[model samples]
Every structure is written in C-alpha cells, then in structure tokens.
Target: MKPIELMRAEAVNLTEDPDEVCGYWRGHLVWVKQEDADGLWYVRVNHPDGGYLYDGFWRAHRDCTAADAVAEAFRGAELLEDE
Candidate 1:
C-alpha cells in the first residue's frame, strides 16, 4: 500500500476526493481523512471558528465504521451558525 501522505495527495486528484471532504464533526462541517494511516486512522476535526484539532492520530480506527461514528456524533451535535 502507498503511504498515507501519498494516498491523500492522490485523493486530491480524484473527482471525488475523499481526503478533501467535509463531514460532521462537533456540529461543524469538518475536513477529515477517512482512511487509515500506518495501520491507524484519525479524527482530525476542523472547528468552524477558524481553529482545528488533530492529536497525533491517537483516535485510531481499524475500519471506516469508527470514522463514520465520528461523523454521526458530529451530526448529532447542535448545528453551528458558521458551519
């Protein structure tokens, strides 16, 4: 498999770039990488207030379901005006 970094770059070139996608994360449409990197995935949430959070890819995931859960949780959060 290709490195996650390279994979992300390739995704950007695709018509529907999954890496460059925005999903629900804490009441906001956040940009996230919905795939594993180095045997793990992340929950890098983008805050609508111009700030963001990404903690060492600690929120590891062995499948997309986990990542989708994050999105679900975010969707459940109260929608923000800015988002």
Candidate 2:
C-alpha cells in the first residue's frame, strides 16, 4: 500500500470566498467554494501531462487546523467526486 500524498498551499483572504484567493489552484477556472473563514486554502494536483487538476474545495475553521481538515475532506470526497 502506498501512503497518500497531499500538496498543501495557502492564500490570503482577498474576499470572504475561499475560491477567490485559491482560484490559482483551479488553474483560474474558479474552484467551488468549500469554506471561507480567516484565510483561504486550496488543493491542486498535477495531471498526467503536467497540467493542473482541480480536486475540490476545503473549509477551514479558526479553531482547527486547515491542513488536516482539508486533507481529510479531500480523501473523503475523492470517491464521491469520481462517482
């Protein structure tokens, strides 16, 4: 079994929308707004051809760590998104 790998990145709160600041993660396609609070976070993976592939959105709370929540959310949402 291979361990799951995640690419973590951060962005500022230009607005209240997580997708706006993290828009770069979606290759500027505008990722779906997952959650917005203090800062913005996004997940983008490289495609087979080296292009960016938008995974989804992640909502972070001030009380919790965004990285952990984002990773867990992505892992859980991966299968649902594929279906």
Candidate 3:
C-alpha cells in the first residue's frame, strides 16, 4: 500500500512519549509517522513547527517545500519496506 499524503494542518505536540505522539499523527491517516525522539516528531508531510507542548491542535496545511515534501514522502515509503 502507498503512504497517504496529508496537508499539515498544524504542528502537533508529541510531548514526552514518542510512541504516543507518533500514534496521534498516524491516527490522522493522512501522513505517516517516521522518527519520534528528543521531543521532536517527524511527519511524512510538511507543515509548520506548530511549537511543542501547545494545547489544542493548531490548524495548518501541508504547504511544504517540494524538496521537503519529497524527502518526507520518501522516508515514509521506506518505512513501509521495513514493515
């Protein structure tokens, strides 16, 4: 199956738990969660930093630079290979 493309609606707060944080992003079903560590959550889609530990889901869109979006997409695709 191909990875889904989602416009980043806003930066998501992963908090301390990378697993739970990534789970939230994956739950969106738009973008695939890649690496979550050091309080940083990387998504397969492009959006804003949206700051960390902010309350509520900030609203943004997937307006990522072509290069970034491509890179993230590639990473997401690679993850599928491992699975």
Candidate number achieving the greatest lDDT relative to the actual structure? 1
Each prediction's TM-score versus the true structure = 0.34, 0.30, 0.20
Evaluated with TM-score, which candidate comes out highest?
A: 1
Q: Quote model 2's TM-score.
A: 0.30
Residues 1-83 of candidate 2: C-alpha lDDT, one tens digit per residue: 11122222332221223233222222222223335565344544434355544464454565544334444434543522543
Tell how far residue 30 is off in model 1, in angstroms: 1.5
Summarize candidate 3's per-residue lDDT along 1-83 as a digit string, tens digits. Answer: 32222223332443223122221343332233323232232443332343322222222234433334323443544433446
lDDT of each: 0.39, 0.37, 0.32
Question: lDDT score, residue 80, model 2?
Answer: 26
Cα lDDT tens digits for candidate 1, 1-83: 22233223433322224433444433433444545543344444445575554323434344544435344324433233235
lDDT-best of 1 and 3: 1
Show where candidate 3 strays beyond 4 Å: 1-63, 79-83
